[model samples]
Target chain A: MTARFAVGDRVRVDDRTPPGHIRTPWYIRGKSGVVADMVGAFADPEDSARGGDGLPERPLYRVRFRQTVAWPDYAGDGRDTVDIEIFEHWLEPESG
Target chain B: MSTNVDDHDHDHARTFVPDEEDSLGQYAIVEMAVRELLIEKGVFSADEFRQGLEVFDKAGPHLGARAVARAWTDPAYKESLLSDGSAAVKEFGVDMNLTELYVVENTPRVHNVIVCTLCSCYPKPLLGAPPDWYKSRNYRSRMVREPRAVLAEFGTTLPDGVEVRVHDSTATMRYMVLPMRPEGTADLTREQLEALVNRDAMIGVTVVPAP
Candidate 1:
C-alpha cells in the first residue's frame, strides 16, 4: 500500500489491540505525531499468513513525536522530541 | 549506570546455582542433539559447525569503532557515512551479506534511540552479538516506555532541552547511532575519538566522553 502521509504532515499512531504475531512497539501505540520522513517501502513482514513466497510491499514513515504531547506531565523540558520510523499500518490521520 | 550485574540482583542469591547448569551441560543436551540430528541427516558436517563457532567467537565491536574513527578523520568519508553506511564501512573492510547497516545521527534537538523488539538485531559484523542485557525482555519492554529512566540507569541523563529519538531495530535494517562529538577533545585524533565512543553511545544510552 502507498504511504498516506508525507514529511511534515501531522499524523498519529493508531492504537489498535492486535492479537498474536505482532510487532508494532507497545510504547508507540496510540501516540500522536507528525510524519518526519518517508523511508522507502519494503515487503510487509507481518503478512506472512498470505501463503505466498513473497508478500505485498508497503511504505514506512518516520514520525517525529514531542515527548510533552506523548506523556503529559513529563517533567523534562518540552523541547524533547522522539522520531521513530513506523510501518504504514501503525499510523492514521489525526482526528482533532 | 553500574555495570555491576549484582547491584540489581536483590533476589538473585535465592536463585543462584553456580554449579547447577554448565554451558557444556546445556550444549551437550540440546545443541548436541541438534548437531547430531543435522549430522545424521547430512545437513552439515561437524567440522563446518565447529568452524562457524570459531568465526563467531572472533567477531566484535572494535571493527565498527575503527570504521567510526576513520569516518571522523575523513570529511569526504563522513559524507559517505551520512549517505550510505554499508559502503562507507567497506572502506574499513567490514562486510556482511545478510546484514545491512543504517547509521542514525544524534542532534541537539533530536536524539536517536534503538531497540530490538523482536530479537537483538545488532551490528554483529562491527559491534559483535548483542550483550546479554540487550537481549533481555526487560530492556525491550521498558526502553520504549521509559527511555529517560533507562538512560539514567545507564548514567546518561539528557539535558533539559535535548530531544530523544528512539529507533527500534526490529526489521531488515540494523541500526547504530553516530553520537555527537564531545567538547574538550579539540586536538584528539580519530583514534582518540573512537576510544571515546562507547557501546552505550552507539545504543543512545550514554553520550561519548564518559558523560
Candidate 2:
C-alpha cells in the first residue's frame, strides 16, 4: 500500500501484456514518464476484475510524459504532454 | 391491412424498422441482470437504486458551470478548486462519492483537455453522461496522440507557444477542465458568466468567446 515512486521521480511503464481486463493502456506501456502525483492506492483492477478481494490496494500515480514520447510523429509543440494514471506495479525505475 | 394506426402499413416499403440497433448490448444486459440480482438479494433496496438514478438524472454541465463562475469571480475559491477538486466542488453540492475529481486549469501557456483513452470515465456528477463523441473510439485513441489536431477539429486552435496538455482518464479519477475565462467579460455578472460556460468549454474541446 506504500508508494515507491514519489512526485518528480522518473519511471518507465512496464511493457507486459496479460490476459483479462487491464487498467493500463497499451499505448503507454514501455514508455517513460515522470511521476507527477501520488494517487494513493486502490484495488488493482487486474485482480479485482477476476473476482478477487483486491486486498492490499496498489499505489497509483499520475505519470506525465511528453507527447512526443507517445507519438514521435506528433506535430504540436514539443512541450505538449499527456498525463495518465498508472498503478505502481506497472511502473519501474527508469534505467537511463 | 394495418391493425395498428402507428404502423402505417399503407407504405410500399416499411424499411424493416428504422432502428434494429435499439437493443441493449451484452454488457448493458449483464449490468441490468446484476442490478436486479443485487436488489433482490437485499444488497440495496429498489428505492435506494432509484434515488441513485435521481442524483445522476439531476446532473448536467450547469453544475460545473456554476463552479467555474465561482472560481472566476473569487481568487481564494479558485485556489481551493485547483488544489482539491472534489472538495471544492462539494461546496457547490457535487458529491462524486467514491470517484475522485481532478480539475485541470487552462492557462495562457497551457491548454488542458480531458479524455478516457480506455473508456468514458468523465466527471459525470458535475457534467452528466459524456457526449457520444467523447465515447467514440476515434477520440479515445487519437486525443492523447494528436490533441492539437483534435482541437482543430473542434475549431479550437491554440497559439503556437501554448502547450496542449491531454489528460487520459484511464483510472478511477475523473477529470474536468477549468477553461480560461474569455476576455471582455470583466463587467459581466456571475450568472452571466455561468451562462457563457458551456459543456464543450468545460470538456476542453472548445474555448468560449465573450459576447
- The superposed Cα distance between candidate 2 and the true structure at residue A78, in angstroms, equals 1.2
TM-score of chain A of 2: 0.96
- Model 2 whole-model lDDT (C-alpha atoms): 0.90
Write one digit per residue (lDDT tens) for candidate 2, span B29-139: 898899999999999999999999999998999999998999999999899888888999998788998789888899999899999988799999989999999999999
Query: Looking at candidate 1, what is the lDDT of residue B130?
Result: 81
Clashes within 3 Å, all models in order: 4, 0
**Best-fitting candidate, scored by TM-score:** 2
Q: Per-residue CA lDDT of candidate 1, range B1-211, in tens?
A: 3456677564465456455454476556787799899998999998999977776765666766666666667778778876777777776666754556778877777677788866677887767788898889999876755788888898887777777777777555667888777777668887787887778777788787732
**Candidate with best DockQ:** 2
Model 1 pairs whose backbones collide: B1-B154, B1-B155, B113-B165, B113-B167
TM of chain B, each: 0.78, 0.84
Kindly give the stretch of ten consecutive residues in candidate 1 chain A with the minimal lDDT sum. A48-57
lDDT of each: 0.73, 0.90
